[model samples]
Target: MTDITDAAKRLLLGKPMSSERLGHTLLPKRLALPIFASDALSSVAYAPDEILLTLALAGVAGTIWTPWVGLAVVLVLVVVVASYRQNVHAYPSGGGDYEVVTENLGKNAGLAVASALLVDYVLTVAVSISSASQYVASVFPALRGSEVIVAISVVVFLTFMNLRGVKESGKAFAIPVYMFMGAIGLMAMFGFFQYLTGSLGEAESAGFVLTTSEAYDQGLVGLGGALLFARAFASGCAALTGVEAISNGVPSFKRPKSRNAATTLLMLGTISASMLTVILLLAMETGVKYAENPAEQLRTVSGGAIPDDYVQHPVISQLAEVIFSGAPWLFMLVSAVTGLILMLAANTAFNGFPILGSILARDGYLPRQMHTRGDRLAFSNGIMTLATGAIVLIWVFDAQVTKLIQLYIVGVFISFTLSQLGMVRHWTGKLRKASDPRERSSMRRSRVINVIGFLLTGTVLIVVLITKFTHGAWITLLIMALLFLLMRSIRKHYDSVIEELALGDDLAAARALPSRVHAIVLVSRIHKPTMRAVSYARATRPSVLEAVTVGVDENEIATLQAEWQKMDVPVPLRVLNSPFREITRPVLSYVRSVRRQSPRDLVVVYVPEYVVGHWWEQLLHNQSAIRLKSRLLFTPGVVVSSVPWQLSSSQGHGVETTYFPQSGQPPAMEDRKR
Candidate 1:
């Protein structure tokens, strides 16, 4: 079983890369762009849909504001990109927002950013994968109801690909990411060309009359109307989700890491903003209509209910269908690549989450195991942790992009606001210390950019909180708070442990030895295992030695005594009465009594255990011994050790077999009969 599992793991993850090969995993700018920017790049696919969906709540009057809201989101994206470019140049350690905020705003603020980023990374996977599943369903209508399953399967696949190693997965995903870019770019070109030539056609849904619900029957008016647009802009900000990933993943880039990372960030921002602008423009020109509840919110021009079997495809799909009306294959290609990119978009989180987790772990904010690299030189624990989180979220939300998206962007925006604020502080500090005129001028300019970024992101953060609070954004904020507290608790525990274990100046106290060692061998029967336990205990050369057992069965005890007396074993056997037949309690009581009698003396309990070859054999033995050892471990001056006796079935299963002197077989097995 172990061999098969190892083989399967190797087949899936590929052979483990040595630590020396870590340098080879560094990503070039081309690959790093896809690895770190896929999420931001792919968001153009759904950000428009979200904007239109939100505006649709106000009916047709609301949908007309899509372009303005999209432009607003793009403005924030560009500023965030510029702000983070400065972040990379200043703090190139790949700690990203956490490091910058911790350094400038103090540790508490840093932890807040860390928790926010962690939550956002998780949402990135859930929302991106769920959106991808939607695209898949659009292509193959038969798979519509199974979006949850499809999304989870894609998550597992991405996890496996990432576990293989960053460089390997980056190479594999680069093609799909570029294909998505090409497909979108081509569609945008053709879409605008057709519009310029007066040959563009209306969307299939263009003929459908969108009606206002009671909530927005008065149209975009008063406070409610203002709040509605705020909400729409907040939703469209989801496009900026992956922009910070580049800052977080700076170390993954090749030499000139900061420069390459900054360049990639600019490229990502430009591409994302352009694509979003084009998509929204084309949607408006094509008269696309998208709603949170399509069937109930949309009706035929004749005022009749739409068919129950009608499917409302996403905005990109609708745009493709109309823009490529003469070419059916282009529409399919557009849909396929959009889905492919959305799925690969999760790769950004896969790459960013682990690195951030490792950084947090290194700072004692997470489990130490998260800091360790796996066979592939990746933070495997963190990768698996992210994957598990995403799968749970996908399952809980039923893989609906609309539902999952409600919980998205809240976290990324939180990080963005704080990180930009930190950058502003960082540049201010640099300017204060700089004497060079050129350096001071550059610092002031960078500071201004970050100041603008902070104002914009902070305002958006407030709008997101106020507008999306009841719409499931509150859940994200709650989770971020809990994670903040949890990380604090973890760091406190690690700090306490460190302080308690720190070396003191008292050498004598540190090197003090126990007065004496008392050894006890636990026996279940007068068999080879018991004999081996006795022999090993005797070899320890303790001041006192004895064999102990619980009196579970009188008749068996009598028979065991008879055999012991007949063999004249050197060690004496002491049995503790267990009227209730509780092995662990009686043994624990006896060991504690021994410790109480000699406070300064050391007590060692040797347990005889079976060495099993198969997994199932583990269940048949040593359960009571395990329980007893666990109890004894907490007792002061008490030590627990296991003495293993391998059975015939335990051979050739990887564990080394040791032949004890008291065993029937010779050390070399020369005298044993086959």
Candidate 2:
């Protein structure tokens, strides 16, 4: 029997969990909708702010075009959702876009999508936590400079929840997710009712006089104006960041995985689109406006100066204040819920990056340890890596959502474009093989959707690069390139190791025993361990055998020789002098000389080792034998074995127990009894 150590037992806590238990970690459609869709859905919290801030570059009149930008983003969103529905049905292995592009296209294209999604997952954690921090700061002004700490703390909390396992985290997030949806829905409903009653009032920031930046001073009538519109559209596309998570998570769904995932995607699209559209329309109807430099762009219409100390609250806060109409409790509830939901958005990446890492590990593209699930069946290593990366980003960017926002959305669009391109190829291949007319028609329709998705996402990608690359998107691209090279090197190393370990016909010839056997027993004192070593070696029936000890002190050597003679041991005892008291070097030189004497023979060195229960016991004894064994391992054609003798302290401790019989014979007591 193999004695499992405590460390080994702890490390394998969740090994070999059944696939059926995996379903318990598997998400139902209702919980899955929020778990996977939170990223895209929560974008409504900040996407409008991005759009308005970009349009504000051209002053208030430029902001008038915000509704049109929202409309364009919605059109693109619809096309992407329809196209990915085809992707789910066609390739639902949960490799998501990475596998699809790599399989249909080539490795380079697939790697490109993988790099993009990797960067996107990082930014998702950074941006969501930062935005949530801003919401918290609005309610509690004391947390102003501590935003980075707050954001990183939230990320760490989510990481631990995810490490507990997928189903556990999903259930934890269900209530807050639903509350977010309900709060946003109620706010939108009341705002719409106020508008219908002809009693809707302007946002808190509405009456501030607008000032245009030099880039947008021309006010919507020139080349600069068109470019500003493109920039705003690109920024608004931030809402699409989490769309690909569903395709990556298809395997985590209940039975009919793809269909359930596709349905969840549709629900995600409908709810996100409706909420975003309603928010933008209400912002327009309520005369809400935003600026990157709020203090500079905003002024009192009464010719009084707006306070320099005033912090411009987020668009959600401003809108909620007006909609709730002095109902302080309702206002507080909505703000709290929104902040909580945004923090939970990090859960999307928490679930996503680990699952993708496990797939890559299985394919030899990542460290194999990532494939090992933890006590709760979660990928703990991947989760820790994700948390560390997100924390570094949050700190480096100072947890400013507006600044970090510029680096967002570029990766997701790159993946969207490539994945849609892959789907186009998939449908084309199916069309060529289909003999039935109905199947051919369906393939053709799917191809059309994918083509449109490709075009739309490609355009958005280009616009984001043009607008945001200099701001911060280039940094994200560089990070992705580094990760790509890293994963490639890891895969190469694994492949090389596998090749080195492969067996061939030469192994049999190598396994044959040498023509002769010579054994040497290493002894320090004539104790039980030393006796055990001698007995085990003699049982091997070697052609030659001797007991050797290093002579470090003359008195000790004389005492040992007397003890050996008194016992009248059958084995001849030999002692080697060590002038410098260097045990390892003398033993190594002696073993080499013996091997040279019989070059064709095998040399087996047996060193008796003491097995101690406590680690500290090792420090007090066995120094010479340990050093000798270490040197012997490097010698060619030498097999070193340890004959363990458990100490009195080691007994009843269940330490270093073994079940294998001795090399050639049973125990002396057992042989006597027989």
Candidate 3:
């Protein structure tokens, strides 16, 4: 069974690499771009849709502002990337926003930033995969209503790919991500060329006008219109979702990690900004109309209401349809790669979240299991956790990109604001300690850049909260607060444990000898195993030894008493009755009572257990003895030991005849067969 399982694992994930070979997995810049930058670049698929969807609440006039909103988003993206480049250089420890905030702002602030970024990473996976499923469903209309299942399956696939090792997954994803980029670039360039030649055409939906909600039917003539545009700007900021992944993953880069990370950050910002700009312009020029509910919000040019079956495709789909007009394959190719890239975008979060989780776990803020690397050198616990959280979000939102998107950007902006604030303080502190003129001037310039980042992200945070709080952003804030408190509690527990373990001048107390030894063998039935336990306890030469049993059934206790007397054992037999028929509680109470009477005396308990060659036979015996031994260990001044008697079924299995089960024994089988 073990050989088959191992062979399957090797076939699925390749040969398991050793810890010494971990450095062989460090990524080059080309692979790192797809692994780290896909999320930010792929947001072009949905960021424009969000901009158009939110703007559609007002009227067709509202869609005209898509370019300006895209520009604002681009500017914020630039500042964030520049500020994080400074972070990767200064703190190249790969702590990312959490490290920066923790170092400059102290532990509590750092915990807050960690909590926010952790939440952000999970949402990045959810939003990206959900949007990708939308694109896929657009290409295949038969899958329209089952997007949730498709999104979840893609998430599981990504999790398996990531668990294979970071560089392995990076190489696997590089081509599709680059193909996506080239496809978008080619589509946009061809689109513009045709526009210059006066042959560019409108979207299929361009003829059908979008009717605004009653509140905005007048079209940008009131105070409500201004608030709607602000909301649109806030939603479009989704393009910056994965911008911090490069900073968080500096350690994964090859030799010059910091320099490579900075370069990657610059490239990510540039490509994302350009793609977002081009997509927004194409949507505006082609008059692509996307509404939250197209059946009700859309009508014919002759003023008739559209049918309820009308489906509103996203901005990119609409643009691809027009740009690749005659060439069906080009449109299909663009659609296929677009869907794949959107799904693969979650890989950036997969790469970043686990590394950050390891850092947090090492700092005692999360479970220690997360700190350990798997055979593939990935944080296996963190990967599983991210997958679980993203799947839950996908399930809750029914894989609707528009609804899940409402919960996006809040956590990223939180990390962004805190990270920039930390950078400003970092540079300021450096300038104060530096005496060199050149270094001082350099610090001054970096400080100005971080300050701008701080202001920009801070204002966007307020706008996001005010516009999206009631919609879904508050759920993110609540999750962040809960995570912050949970991490604090974990740290408090680890600190208390450390304090308790600090050996002081109490060595004399630990070395004190006990007054006497009392040996008690826990007997379940008068069998060979019980006789062996009784014989072993008597030979120990203790001050006093006796056989003890819990009376679970009256008739069974009577039979055991008769058999013990027939054996003529030297030790006395004591039977404790349980009116409620419990084993562990009665034994625990009796052991504690002995310690309460004589605090200095040591109580030793010997439990008789069965060792069977076959797995199922072992479960048939030693049930009560195991529980009693466990309960006795927790009693003060007590030592619990097990004595094993090999059953006849164990003779031919090359058994070790040990008292305890082997550590490699399958725990699930014990639980199931027992």
Q: How close is every model to the real structure, measured as TM-score?
A: 0.96, 0.86, 0.91
Candidate 2's residue-wise lDDT over 109-140, tens digit each? 88778878877888899999999999998888
The ten-residue window of minimal lDDT in model 3 covers: 661-670
Mind giving the per-residue lDDT tens digits that candidate 3 earns over 463-516?
A: 999999999999999999999999999999999999887767899876788888
Query: In model 2, what lDDT does residue 115 have?
Result: 76
lDDT for model 2: 0.86
RMSD of each: 2.8, 4.5, 4.4
Flag regions of model 2 displaced more than 4 Å.
1-20, 302-305, 505-507, 510-674
The better-scoring model by TM-score among 2 and 3 is 3
- Best TM-score among the predictions, by candidate number: 1
Between 1 and 2, whose TM-score is larger?
1
- Angstrom error at residue 205, model 1: 0.7
lDDT values for all models = 0.90, 0.86, 0.87
State model 1's lDDT. 0.90
Per-residue lDDT of candidate 1, residues 1-674 (tens digit): 76788899999999988889999999999999989999999999999999999899888899888888988888888888989889999989999999999999999999999999999999999999999999999999999899999999999999999999999999999999999999989999999999999999999899888888788898889899999999999889999999889999999999899999999999998999999999999999999989888789899999998888889999999999998989999999999999999999999999999999999999999999999999999999999999999999999999988888889888888888898888888888888899999999999999999999999999999999999889899899999999999999999999999989876898888789988988898988887777767767776677999999889999988998888889998888898999998888898888889989999888888888888877788898778887887788788888788777777777776546764433232322321221
